[model samples]
Target chain A: MEKMTLSSKTREAQSPTEQWMRYLGFPGGILLFLLILYLPAGAGLSAGAQAGAASFALALVWWVTEPFPTYVTSLVLMFLLLVTRTSNAKAIMDVLGMEVIWLNLLAFILASMLVKTRLAKRMALWLVVRFGHKASWALLAFLVLQLVLAPLIPATAARCVMTLPLMIVVATIYGSTEATPNNFGKNMMLLNLACISVLSSITMTGSSANLIAVGLIQNMGGQRVYYMDWMRVGAPVAILTMVLMWILGQKLLFRMKPEEQVPQVEGGLELVKKQYELMGPLGFQEKKAIAIFGLVLFLWMTDIFHMRWFGVEISAPFAALLGAVIVLFPRWGILSWAEADIPWHLLIFSAGAYAGGLALDDTGAAEWGVRMLFGGMNLKGVPFGFTYTVVISVMMYSHLLTTSKTVRTLIMLPIIITLAKALGWSPMSLALPAALCIDWVVGLPISGKPNVIMFSTNQYSVGDNFKYGILTCTIGVVILVISGATWFHWLGITPSFWAVAP
Target chain B: MKTLRLTAFILLASVLAMAVDLPTYTVRLQAAPDGSGQGIATIALAGCTPGTFNLPLGFTAVQDLRVEEPASGIRLESSERNGMTQLKVTLPPDIPAKATLKVSFRLKQVFQIVKLKPGEKSTLPATSRTFKHAFVNTQEYLIGAYRVEFLFPDGLMAQAIREQLPKPAKNEVGPRVLLSKVDGHQAAILQFNKLQQGDDTSMIVELVPTRRSFGWLIAGLLLGGLYLFKFKDLVATKQP
Candidate 1:
């Protein structure tokens, strides 16, 4: 198992849907595009709007089925938007320069700082050594580590990279490997994946998708969502979802035996401690990384006080940028320019998705579609709970359709905002909760970056990931629904009892 | 002598037996981005006569009115009526009596400085332009079909507000229902089939311009270039 290559682990059996999509997704996307473009529908829709919808349809199908790499599909999407005249060349090209894209770049830089100094691994090792006496405690240790690292490191993939080796070591101690696996490994791997993905919802900077949602709310909904505003709603819901997922995985889904719960290998607990001791004491670079990360986290948390403290507020991107600048500031900084692990391809993907979404909006295609949808559904007299539930469920489960959370965010949030506005509900009321669901990208290996990393471990099968992922997502939907009625109501993000539309 | 007189009178009466029939008039009104408008009216006439045909142009403050035969493309200026502009078309003496003529009347500034009423404020940045264009059959003779089209500017995206208007009575012929074809190239079309003499049809529309801008494109390119040049190798290895 240890000698197995990464591709061998990643090349698991494909589900029927994936197989079909792999074969026919490209041509199917083209067909859909042509059909929507030439169809004599919606006499009131503008030519630009019609063209925008067609371009988006093609991109959506291609992104979901993945006929090409998602980034390649995105490049194609950008080209389509320009050639189809759905959006101007300048607008489509400018998507790479959006503030959300910048924030994602700076965030990866900050993550690289933590990873370069090995502070992330050190922290994870310390937690596991402190709490790896039992299998249950070990899992909780990882969960806690994820919660700790989520805000400090905005990139989930980076967090997963830091902890993957540790998870592999601990799984081996439990006598679980690709050749021989057990319930303990399944629970361990799946729970950690859920943790890394779900805990990201706790902060607005947790993912690129969250920031895009915020930008849409500000631009389209005319409501600015501050960092604290997101945390005020997102933190509770995400933490609860993580806790429930842990419980469901340990107690119900993957129950370990008494001996399996303990380390099956000799001196398993000692091994973790030995690993922690091998790291030795925290070095000067680790200390510097901590101080910089701490300052950044402090500024992020204390944004509400910035206006009173210094007569101005430091935005999330600016805060991350300041930290990144220090991390690369001459010899005093920890990393050289080359050391920063910025994924230009992912940025390209993000730019194209943003361009498509903005084109739909600029051409009024998104709004027109939303209006037509509501007009057809006749949701005027429906109760608010039902509507909220539908919106929340769709958003939470939308990971099954598209793998990229950034694309999903660009596709859904504006329509959700428009839907809410069309229905006379507050856009934030629906969009914020949906935005909180952006990081629940754990339903498949291709669902998220972290899932891909964790899946490549090969300690669990695709079936295990799927079953556990679907159950965990359903559990998440229930938690969010209840929170929408109770916790969010108490926080006033939603109405109490959902008595009346806003 | 009496037989000769009867024959000459029969010829004169045959020449005097000219009649005119107004079948349909389709008017196309196009609005410019600068708030000006132009219109083209295609009028179908049968039973041609060598006499003047007074066609009422249902527009206010019409300017640069020009008429031409659709088939021949021959430009001709028709006399206009004061107060409410009417086209005075003179049929030629050599026109075949059985031939139906199609004449095109082109008018500029048909909607001169239309005063668009302001609508309610919305969360969107677009401002609303609300106005009404009335299509009235000012002719004394009944019109077979009177069609009017109001078109928005090219490449402009807008949303039509759903304003409720009272339905026409069952016994009465209210103006034909307004069909807003703002989608694609279709305009807001109003068709009044068999419009009675001097009857008018009008509908109000509120158009909200939904144009969006793409600023900071150059800035994006600069940043992207800097990243590519500074960390170009990362792009090869760190592809997501």
Candidate 2:
């Protein structure tokens, strides 16, 4: 069994061709942008819309290839849009200040507080102590942590950041180091990446992408989707898929040895318990963090109550910002501004992507694209069942083209809503299912923020993630389709095949 | 007796034919704060004899109705038929070949706040409420340049605008005073130049954040102070 290690040497040893390809990605993106902009004026899109499309293509390329830092590409995208005059500066800045961006920022601050107070470590240790006797149980414990935190955290990247330290500790405890990796480390890290990305779709506020989709849906004149309604449709799919992921990881992909299955060291449990002891009892800061987080969770869950009675709507971002403010307040707060570990790069990237997306909508590029592609196809006459299958399939595989889930949601939901409107079908039926597939961005290492973060662990290679990811993604698609046809059909979200003439 | 009956039938047939040949009516409505408005509609009747003409006013109550004709005092009468108010006005018997009849009315328009989600049904106190959009039903006529002006309460500012139609031709933000009240407010006016007959329109105007959210800032500061004093070590120590 080979142990896992985080070595910088491995990353520096890229082949000459790989390096050249990385450098070529930027110009390639620029060329694609120009090609789209120079398309025949008769293509039926306004010049501004064409410019928006060009910038979007360029950003997608840069995000996937990482010729520069992902954040730098985001900056480049903003600069390009400004130079092209696709949208004004004020409009682009507004996109940056949207509630979705605020939610992510506040969640990052809260995550930093959790890490600083060592509360995250304490919780992780308690779970390890209870379930660390066996490798399978430890994996299940991590999965359970993700499931519990999914609804409350709101940011998949933040959840992954909080859980990564625990995962590394667990991997180390299992005799898995960088130099000598084992099946246990590989399965654990890969599963971590998958669970973090997939489970986010289970709640409306689980990720920024979900919120973006909801906002677009509401903006398009669809019925406002409530929190409970999202959970009712998403929880079953999420829970079932997570269980299947565990089974696939343990049984099919990585078979474990007897020694690896249990604690490899005689005093493995002792080491974890001693670490827990070193932290001592819960400090006042830990208690305060818990209290604030609890309040935030309560507000997020019961937003409907406030909205109905007080006529006050406390959005997820507002709730998270409340908690963060409480945690970082001077003298009373647990952390200072300097202590907070917010990832500005991710925020910048998201802001630029959002700006491009808004331009796509405001300039009518997405709508035009949809009309041009599907206008003459007469998709309205197609059976609803077939259309549902096709939309779900396209949404599932779309991760191959773009890396950011926010960008994917921005590009796809509007088009799907437009298509649904044209076809005389319910927008929610298409948009909701497509939105659920937002977090299936596990096909490549750079597919999602969490995936990128997990890749830094170096416990698993890109091939390991792709091989497992593709299989599970296929399984997920099947599960989603079957659910849409059967379970969701019973729930009236999708039309049953029996009801159709096909 | 047969000749008298034929004369009566001829007169009735002539009136029916004139009704069928009446030209289309075009109206321009301006919505104000507090959901009240006024509109002026022009009915063209070239090359046709003048008679009593009926115009339907969707579902709004008209406070006053009149016909604007020079040197003519034409009385206007209104009645409810099939859940709609129909305004009847009489034109001169010797109307010219290219004359236009203008009808105007003060509207006490009441728009329903569109409920997009199930949880939005509960009644709340007026002070804490913020409505995103209102729906106006315009299924009565082929409206031309139908405009709506949303006046937000004092201290509220417009943030964003969304409409179901292919983006509004003219969406401008300005200042306005609340109707029947002394409070000043911001106004967002959205214009739709042409609306197909029997189609309804909806608009959502998002508002800037109110001062109520400042409570969160204060709470955060208090909590931060308490943590800094009680658990200084935890705050000072950085995690690995």
Candidate 3:
């Protein structure tokens, strides 16, 4: 009784750190407001720099503390960008205005409905009964599905958001002994799903960042990497890597005997069936969710080939907003008045990230960074082909600091380009290194959006991620560096290892 | 042996720092009424050297300098400094597309020796700045600005004008980038924007420090600073 009373009293008194953290969320917003005001007017250093810095701090807070709703922070970031004039006000508010976001919205809505109705569990068990005789083969099928779909779907978060539910279903079927998945096999299975989707995105159409790289490369007057050519290289690399990942999984993590008897579960199957049946008739909400999802995909896939045919120049963002609108339609039920189901805070964080990159441009913060890089190399690494290796290695390791691939790409690509040419070398050397190297990050759910969404399933942990991710990335970087070197000479595309003359 | 080597190094360094004069000569021409298209550009070099010089194929040797020709392809083969070398070639009035008049670049070495001394400075007049895609904003820094300069004989009446081009503006000294024919001489300097930044001809700066060992640290830190400013926030989450 004394202990209970003591615990109750303790609950009534908050700790110092916790108390400070609670206020950290809102004060952070106001601190940024002050910082924005201090920036010099024309260049936007004071405001833009503050925005980038503030957004970064805010993101750290949200990621660690979870003080505010993720979507609200996303919205807060958008508001910050809007209020500070960091980005086009319209663009900032309507960032989700892209079609790809809609596809994601539609996809997520459907996935949510499927899970909420227990249809996902039913599907998982059904598939396991049909295919679980070989665990690796079942996992391979899931891996292949993600790879094929990633190019079409640009947003990793949306893809992971949809696929996480399915992954959980697989985890349930594979039958780990522990109630919580502290097992090696289950943990690796979760990571394999993410790694495959993340790596396969080398094609111009694969991810938004890839497209941005291609566009930037084209602008450089270099020959464009045709869609087919990109696929030729990307598809093979992805498939080979997938096989390698499977081998690693089986040998190091799984190590199950071939004769390990699979349980022929009559009761388990029956229970799943009964539970699915108890969910009863498909409600209006469930039917509407699937239909809205279908509509979203229809809009999303317009770019599969005939994009111009429909006069669709709208970016992936607007398409997302349009698809999200379906949620508001009277017939298809979704979040009520106060519950938009959007992670506004996370969006704000993303906007703030965007603002930060913009600030780098406006304040010449990026230029300042570039100056710092080549300031030392000026005397020794001349004729710059030698310096190329040094720059590539630095950029590769930069992933250790951040997981937002877009932010890294946005900030580094130009500075590296400028620095290379200054050293009497061509900018072409930086492209492959930039696109292929940033994927070196694979450690935690907080590391990539897909990893985060995968984490939302609450299955994997830090240890699981660190074990496979670090090793995989280390191997991945080494292979890519070699491949890049080989391809550099083989393609004979740039002036390096060769020269242009009259 | 060591003292000899040190003396040699000091001598070479001092020579590089000072002006070494080459031999010079003078040949004057009176425009005699028939010299309607004739002109001359000379300077005062107290101690300067004039070396091998010649006017090659593209230039029409105009002893009289009275013809009006049409050739923009003409380039000066012989670069004879005025005060440094006195026998100046006659220049054409209008150099047209096909006409072999005079301009410069892509000329073979010519042979002419006139004067020598060791103290006067014959200006080594050439400068180039890298034109590259350095800006981090839109990938379009190439379509911006370019500046070039040309020096003539008379410092007082000297004017720089550009013509027969796309976009022209007021240069600091010359007509910005667009120069039309001035005083009917085929001599001029031209500048235009490269197609885009990051193009093959784009200028990039390599901050090469003078000290050999220190340059690497400077470059690494520079690259790190850039990587940080540009990407510090991204990896900020990964930080402890």
Candidate with maximal lDDT: 1
Task: Encode model 1's per-residue lDDT on B1-240: one tens digit a residue.
Answer: 999999999867754564556677777777776666777787776656665546776676677665544332222445545456666655666755444334443344432334435884442223545446565566555777777777766544334322322333222222233434643444666666666766776655445444323222343345435544654332233346
TM-score, cand. 1: 0.55
TM-score of 2: 0.59
List candidate 3 segments past 4 Å from native.
A1-107, A116-119, A134-138, A172-193, A242-295, A304-307, A314-391, A397-411, A416-430, A438-452, A460-472, A491-502, B1-240
Candidate 1, residues A1-502, lDDT tens digits: the string is 1222232322222455565564466666776777776565465565556667787777777666665655677798888787655677888888777766777678667766776787766765566567767788888888887899898777676566556656766676677776667788898899999989998999988887898889888878888898898998888777887888778888898888887887665666676577679889999999999999788777766666889998998876688789999999998999898888776766666677667767765554654554464456655657777888888887887676554677677767877887788888888888999999999988866567677556655667555788888887888888888988888878777765456554
Q: Calculate model 3's interface RMSD in Å.
A: 19.4
Better of 1 and 3 by TM-score: 1
| Each model's fraction of native contacts | 0.12, 0.00, 0.00
DockQ winner among the candidates?
Answer: 1
Per-model RMSD to reference: 17.2, 16.3, 19.5
Q: For residues A1-502, write the lDDT of model 2, one tens digit per residue.
A: 1122223323321345545445555566766776776564322344556667888887877665455655677788888778665777888778668765676678767766766777777876777788987889999988888888877666666567657656766776786656555788888888888888888888888877898888887777365888887888888887888889888898898887777776555566887788778889899988988888788777876776877866898777787878888888888888888777665666676677667766776665664454454455666577877777778877787775555677667667777887777777778878888888888888766566677566656566555777888877788878888888888778777766434322
Question: Which structure is stronger by lDDT: 1 or 3?
Answer: 1
| Off by more than 4 A, model 2 | A1-20, A133-136, A151-233, A249-270, A307-311, A380-384, A395-473, A488-502, B1-141, B144-240
Candidate 3, residues A364-483, lDDT tens digits: the string is 334334435555565244433345455656565555445456656655665565554445454555565555555545655445555544443334433455566665655555555555
> Which portions of model 1 show Cα errors greater than 4 Å?
A1-20, A132-139, A145-238, A247-269, A307-312, A379-502, B1-240
- The CAPRI-style docking tier of model 3 reads incorrect
Flag the better candidate by DockQ, 1 or 3. Answer: 1
Q: Residue by residue across B1-240, what tens digits does model 2's lDDT show? A: 999999999877755655313344445444455556566656554554555656555445666777775314334678876656776655566555555667677766433444558656643223222333332333333444544444554444432243344433211111111111112434544444445545545454433323333442354356435544654442243468
